[model samples]
Target: MYICICNAVKESDIRDAVGAGVSCFKTLSKNLSLCTDCGSCGKKAKQAFHRALAESGASSNVVSIDAMSTAPVRRIQSTIKVSASATHHQKCIKTIL
Candidate 1:
């Protein structure tokens, strides 16, 4: 159900955004960064956005969040140390892949 695995975005999250007055894909993407990584989920995310928008019955007047204050933010650790990776919790995040 996670349309954007890189960002951990789910379809239900999109629906909730629509319900909360996100009337277009661009605004929603700005907040949640949908389809921003890898671009594999662009089609599916767009489809879900439209479907949710239609179901929400909200206006198509192009409402925006944060008024385009800044680019979407994603936090990343500066580096991963081997000792930290040995911990079970961090092991999953800093994995062999």
Candidate 2:
């Protein structure tokens, strides 16, 4: 399913981004160039973002997708990496984001 027609961002890409710790639409837009043009895909992009978060088992309460959009990208990425590392239990996992 294509989430962003302007950027050609697919649902799977959004999910991968979520798995990599992207929790906000803004970060998604910055990283993937989604919803950056025309703004028609904002709603769909947000939906995809939330859906990805849910599927990834991440708590939406911890980081509001709407609020996190305004945060600095580096800060959000670092925080997400830290949290993911802390919660992930498996060994031999070398990378998360």
Candidate 3:
């Protein structure tokens, strides 16, 4: 789907930008000229941009959740407690080492 017909920017392009660390509206405008001209697509573009970001986040979350649900969860071993007084500070003889 085309977000800005004037600039020939597509939804996929926006998604790609979002994936490449383009987070906010200003960065998006600089990258793709979104809402730069007549600004007719401003609202729609913002909506699509946010939607794309949300979808990407949701997809990643789903993948992680699925992996957690399917993978074998191991039981934790015995927990160890150390006394604060047991801590020792060793000085390196090599000054910087």
Candidate 4:
């Protein structure tokens, strides 16, 4: 779904950005020009950011995907492992919700 009409930003773009380690509104704004124009998409952007963070199994609310990509192999593996586990839990909760 489209999040920022002014910038042509979509929910998928936000998810990809989050997977790429954009964890904050500022970084999202800088990278995707999310809320820069009319600032109406800020709330949705934040929601998407948080949802992506939860899905990614990132411990920090302010993770940087660029940094994660550069991290050691073991760390990356662990992140993937955690993300898998979280995905299962999320599915269950989603079904319930």
Q: Candidate 4 on 1-97: residue-level lDDT in tens?
A: 9989999999899889878865455557788987789999988887786787788876463323443356654453344335634454333333322
Q: Which model is ahead, 1 or 2, in terms of TM-score?
A: 2
Candidate 2 Cα misplacement greater than 4 A, ranges: 65-97
What does candidate 2's lDDT look like per residue over 1-97, in tens digits? 9888887889899999889876555567789997678888878887887788888887542344244367664455444334544333112112222
Q: What is the C-alpha RMSD of each candidate to the true structure, in Å?
A: 13.9, 8.8, 17.3, 12.2
User: Where in model 4 is the C-alpha error above 4 Å?
Assistant: 61-97
- Ten-residue stretch with the least lDDT total in model 1: 73-82
**Local lDDT at 88 for model 3:** 16
Expressed as tens digits, the lDDT of each residue in 16-39 for candidate 1 is 998887655666777889767798
Score residue 21 of candidate 1 by CA lDDT: 70
Candidate 1 vs candidate 3: the lDDT winner is: 1
- Backbone clash count for every predicted candidate, in the order shown: 0, 0, 0, 2
Tell me the spans in candidate 3 whose CA falls farther than 4 Å from its real position: 58-97
TM-scores for the candidates? 0.59, 0.60, 0.56, 0.58
lDDT over C-alpha atoms for residue 41 of model 3:
84
Candidate 2 weakest lDDT stretch, 10 residues: 88-97
